[model samples]
Target: MSQHIQRSIDSPLRTGLNREQLWEDHDKGLIKCWEVGRQRAARFPELANQCLAGELPVLGWKGGVSRSLKKLEKFGSLKYLAQWQGLRGEDLNIDLSEERELTCSRTAMVVTFTPDRSKYFNQVAEA
Candidate 1:
C-alpha cells in the first residue's frame, strides 16, 4: 500500500517561461517538463539547478517543479484518465471530453483504482 502524497503546488523556484508560451508550447506538443528538465540538465546542469532554485528563469515560467509537473500533466501528451482516493472517496471519471463524474462511494476503504486505459478504450470502442 503506497500512499500518493500531494506535493506543494508552489515554491520559490522559477522559470522565465511565459504563461501563454508555456501553454502554447504544450498545446503544440513541443516538449514536456520532464523533457525540458532533461534537456536543461544535459545542456547545463548547474544552470538547471539555478533555474530550479529560482535563481534563474526557465522557459519564461516562474514555477516550482511540482507546478511544472502539474501543468505538464494537464496539457502534455500524457493522459491521467482516472484518480481514486479510496473506496469511500469519490470516483473521478475523466473522459475524452473532460467531463468528470462525481459518484458517491458504496463501500468504505481507502483504495485508489485506475482502469487499464488500453483495455477500457478497446471495450468502449467495441461497444
Candidate 2:
C-alpha cells in the first residue's frame, strides 16, 4: 500500500482531508496564530530570541505566509542584511540597490538574488 494509505489506516481517529488539520488544531494552542508580529519574528530565530526576551519595537508580517525582509526593516531587524553579505563575490559587488553599500566579513555565497527585470520596476513603483 502507499505510505499515505498506511498512515490513514494506522490512525483512524484523524478526522480531516489529511493530517494537516489535526496538526494545525494541536499547534493553534501553542502559538498565537492571530499575532502576526510574533510569527514574523519566529521566522528569524535571532529576532525571535529577542522577542521572547522582551525587546523593544517588533517585526510585522503580511502579504503572504512568509515574512518579507524589506518590510521587517521598519522594525530595525537586520537578518536580511547579513544574508546579503553572504552573496557577495571576492570583488564585493553586494549592492542590492544602486544607492546601497553592503559589506560582510564572511565568505561569499554561490547563490545570488537577481531581479525579475520584467517586473522589478513595476513592483518597485507599487512599493
Candidate 3:
C-alpha cells in the first residue's frame, strides 16, 4: 500500500546545492534549445512549414525548396519575378538582414519556383 518516494526539492539544499542556480541553468539550456530551433527553421522555412503542416518530415535538404533569398535576387521581373511575388504574397525585401519575415518569404519563393521556373533556371544557370 506504499507508493514510490521522491526526493523533495529541499533535499538538494540539504546537500548544499542552490535550487535557484539549478533553475537558472535549466532556463539557459531551454533558451539555447529554442534559439537553435529558430535558426533551423530560418534556414529551411518551407521544410519547417511542411513538417508543421504534416506534409513532410524535417528533412533539412527538402527538394525543390529552401533556396537562399540572396541567390533569388538574380532573377528579374522578366524572369518570373511576378510569379514569385504572387505565390509568396510578398515582395523580396533586399535590405533585410536577420528578420524572420524575409526568411519566410524567401522560402515561399523557392517553394513556388521549382514547378514552373525551368526557363528562368536555365537562363540563370547558363550565365
Candidate 4:
C-alpha cells in the first residue's frame, strides 16, 4: 500500500479501519474494486449503462486535467496517452495488455465527470 493511503487509513479522523483490517478484508476478497460515475448513473442511466457494458470507454486522467495537459506538453502526446492509460489501469486493476491502435490527436481534452456536477477539463493540445 502507498504511504499516503496508509496514512489516511491510520488517521482516526480519516477512517476508523486500520491498515491491517483493510488488508485482511482485501485478502479475504471481501472488498471489490472502486466504482466510478455514480452521480452520472443516477442522472443519465442510459449513458452509464453503456459505459458499463463496454460500449464506451470511461475516460479519466492521472490528476487534474490542467496538470495532465501540462504533462502532455512535457512528454508529448503518445507517451502522455500511454502514461494515462497505464496509471488508470493500475488504479482500476484493469488489464490493458490486449493491443489496440491508440491515437492522440492534435486537439485532445480529458473530459471528466464528478466535479460539482460540472465537467472538469483541459485542452490537451493547442490548436
TM-score of each: 0.22, 0.19, 0.23, 0.23
Residue-level error in angstroms, candidate 4, position 106: 23
* Sequence-dependent TM-score of model 2: 0.19
Worst 10 residues of 1 by lDDT: 81-90
**Which number leads on lDDT?**
3
Q: Where is model 3 more than 4 Å wrong at Cα?
A: 1-24, 54-127
Model 2, which residues run further than 4 Å from truth?
A: 1-33, 61-127
Candidate 2: minimum summed lDDT over ten consecutive residues — where? 1-10
Give one digit per residue, the lDDT tens place, for model 3 in 1-127: 2222122211211234455643355232222222233445557667456544423121221223334445543222111221222123232222111111212233543332122234335443311
| Ranking according to lDDT, highest score first | 3, 4, 1, 2
Estimate, for each residue in 25-109, the C-alpha lDDT of model 1 and write its tens digit. 5232122333344444556656545433433122322111222221121111112211111111212222232322222122111
- How high is the lDDT of residue 86 in model 2? 19
Runs in model 1 deviating more than 4 A are 1-31, 52-56, 60-127
TM-score of 3: 0.23
Better candidate by lDDT, 1 or 3: 3
RMSD of 3: 19.3
Task: Give the CA lDDT, 0 to 100, for residue 89 in model 3.
Answer: 27
